[model samples]
Target: MKRFALFALFVLVAAVLTSCGLYNSKMASDPADVETVAVVEDAATEQAEETAEPVVAATEEVVEEAKPAEPQIFEPGSFESPDRCKNCHRDIYNDWKESMHAHAWTEKWYQQDFMMAHHETDGATDLLCGACHAPIAARTGQLPPADGSMFDETAKRGISCDFCHTVTGLDQMYNMGHVSEPGNEKKGPRGDGRSLYHGVKFNENHTKADFCGSCHMVIHPANGTHIIDTWQDWKTNWYGEQNITCQDCHMTPTPGVQETPGRAALLGKWRDNMPYHGFVGASSYVQDAMGNKKQAEMAREYLKSAAEMKLAETVAGDGNLALTVEVHNVGAGHKIPTGTTYIRIMWLEVIVTDATGKVVYSSGLVDEKNHVDPDAVFFRVQFRDADGNLTGKSWRAQGIGYDRRIPAKGMDSETYQIALPAKGEYQVSTRLMYRSFTQATLDEAAERTGEEYPPVESVEMAAAQTRVVF
Candidate 1:
């Protein structure tokens, strides 16, 4: 009877252990508390399995709540006109009124190129070019007519306040990657301001370099060639390393960082620095053509402050004049003439004269026909087409053929060798010149559009003189 009782106790213990193992296995199959309990039959193990179902459901609920929310997209006619914003933001609106952004879509020079590209590509480049130029039209599906006939009044305003302030996110780094969410919610760099008409939200992107980089960096969609590399160049240079953004320089009236202490809107809070919205660049010619004198002067100031010229001279006994001119990019954050370099140009103009003031040598002089010397050393970018021929047209670019622009905080030197006819303390003068658009570009535009444009004037960026005696 004693042996039978001991065997019965052992069998009962084995059955309890087997039951505990089964319960633990079931808990493991569920999504919760599998590792919290062991297979040994204990009070804690029983309690975990009893509460496992609720924990599993709660875990699933937490995961479902962690997913990101979908972005808000607005339809056509949702964005407000610039005139409506001017009621509150008078100063900012005035600054943007004469800016390149304001004339991006309406400018004659841009329309010429855009129309030509449209015709050549059979409307392929309509959306691509208009994405940044006429952003509202592209986003609203008012484009593809290759003209402004289908656009609304707000779409004709170009890069206006509502379009820029309503940007929600970016899909990429180049080719107008900005995503817009047009509504009563206005996004900006600051959020503490109170507005009766709309809700304000702080967008960190407005304070970052990536905001301006989206439109400035242009890439060819078909061939993957970089058409405009301003953003890319700035990103890889010392300015990007130092975290100096485009807004820091371009948004200010002059070059470098200058704070304008004021309110963004008339009813907004006063701040230590409110960004100037002129967006000044090396487009003084465009501004002048558009009859924007203030913006043109500011653009000229920016160009003048960008670089400095230095002269190094050596004269040999055989009357050989060897002059080296170093062009230093002093103020610009990226390369000199950063945007649309194919259509813009910067070159060195050197002139040497004797004591009698007779011209001995000259380079980069504008001819009677208003053209620079073909053999001049041009600091610009050019690309190669599919046939491997060099071309200045951005739409025909397949690969880079020539790229020689002065980098930020960098120096580029060119040495000229000229034989002196008679040397008696010869005076060497040099000027670093910049042109907004090449004469050839405007000539082509005139040929295509049947409109006459004034000759592009050269802006003197920097000058230096030294007396070389032999």
Candidate 2:
């Protein structure tokens, strides 16, 4: 009886184990209910847990892999090159190549001055000059070191094809603070193009005065001084009120308005008027250096048109001759001589001549030192040192105590009364002069190079003749 009972117990245990094994095998095949089956079969459960974790992780990874990645934002520094544009737009490229804008940073004089500044300050402010000269170098994270050794070959080419076209956005006005969006989409005065590489060009900001203001208006970084405020003067006056753009006055061959007709690009359609890239301004020295006599003449004409002078009256008053002179900022959208205030000069000159073509008196004459005659009333911005002393060296200035810039589309007047013991027929003349370098600067250059070059000064004169009775 005991043996029979034991045999039955063994049979029941075998049946239970066989049923669990079969259920786990079916669960393993489906893999869907493996966890539940494994609960009843502990050995199968351990095996399912081990294989299922890896399979589940792999499935998640496959789902993630099915989606695409987002496109990258355009970067200006990554511009391929402007040589690509020359493949189609050969004429425009040639015109740009011959332009002073192309050689701005590469020019010898500019490079010399740049190197001198680097040497003098020990690289403290080389980037300041490079801000305009080599904006590409500055934007490409190549500057601030000021040595120019770390800059790429493309960046060393000064304002090249890539630099201007890659300007996708601007940071500010006058100092040429631009944000580059480098690619085939060349930004210019126009908005129409069919090239797939070029993106949509729809920003009227490119067509306004503010675009030029980015570089034309400059401020002293350390002292918070207004070194060059051409844009500010224009924005505060009639030019701003009339909606006159810098392009309107500057981009044209004419001093005041636009009339050019051409296509902006080879693939692009022809337009009635396109922005002329010559960018002629008041830089006769650069124009002359580039051997562009026509551009130099145009620059001189522009300077002549920039201001108009008028002599209102010349009379004897209380044994003194009284003369009234008026100067109007007629042409420029900003103050005349706006960029690099240290080098830009504007002064009033008055000459009193007697009969027989003999000169009686002269004011505003630049002396051997290139200094303005002390007796003359000069109109200019003055910088001051830390100790409150006046400084002609812009780099040494820590403060600006005075500015007499003529407001855009505005007028400034000065009166001179001189006592004359003997009266004769006197011819009174007034002149507005603009110079890129001071006399002292030229002298220093002569000293360094051991070669003498003539001091360059361009003058605009307004005169009136009157007879004084003795």
Query: Model-by-model lDDT, in order?
Result: 0.75, 0.58
TM-score of each: 0.84, 0.75
lDDT of 2 by residue, 1-470 (tens): 00112223223322332233322434334333222211211111222223221211112232233221111223235645547667766766666665667777776656655665455445544555576677667665576466677777776767777666656566545345566666656676666666765665655667778776766665444443455666666776778888887778776777888678887667678878776666777777667766777777787888887887877664655557777778888877776656665555676788877776677677777666456554454445555444443444444445553455565777777777766556566666678877665555555555655655566655552334455543
User: How many clashes in candidate 1?
Assistant: 0
Tell me the spans in candidate 1 whose CA falls farther than 4 Å from its real position: 1-74
TM-score of candidate 1 to 2 decimals: 0.84
Error of 2 at 465 (Å): 4.9
The superposed Cα distance between candidate 2 and the true structure at residue 300, in angstroms, equals: 0.6
TM-score of 2: 0.75
Candidate 2: segments with Cα more than 4 A from true spot: 1-77, 80-84, 98-100, 172-176, 196-200, 317-319, 366-374, 421-423, 448-454, 461-470
Residue 287 in model 1: lDDT = 90
Worst 10 residues of 1 by lDDT: 35-44
RMSD of 1: 23.7
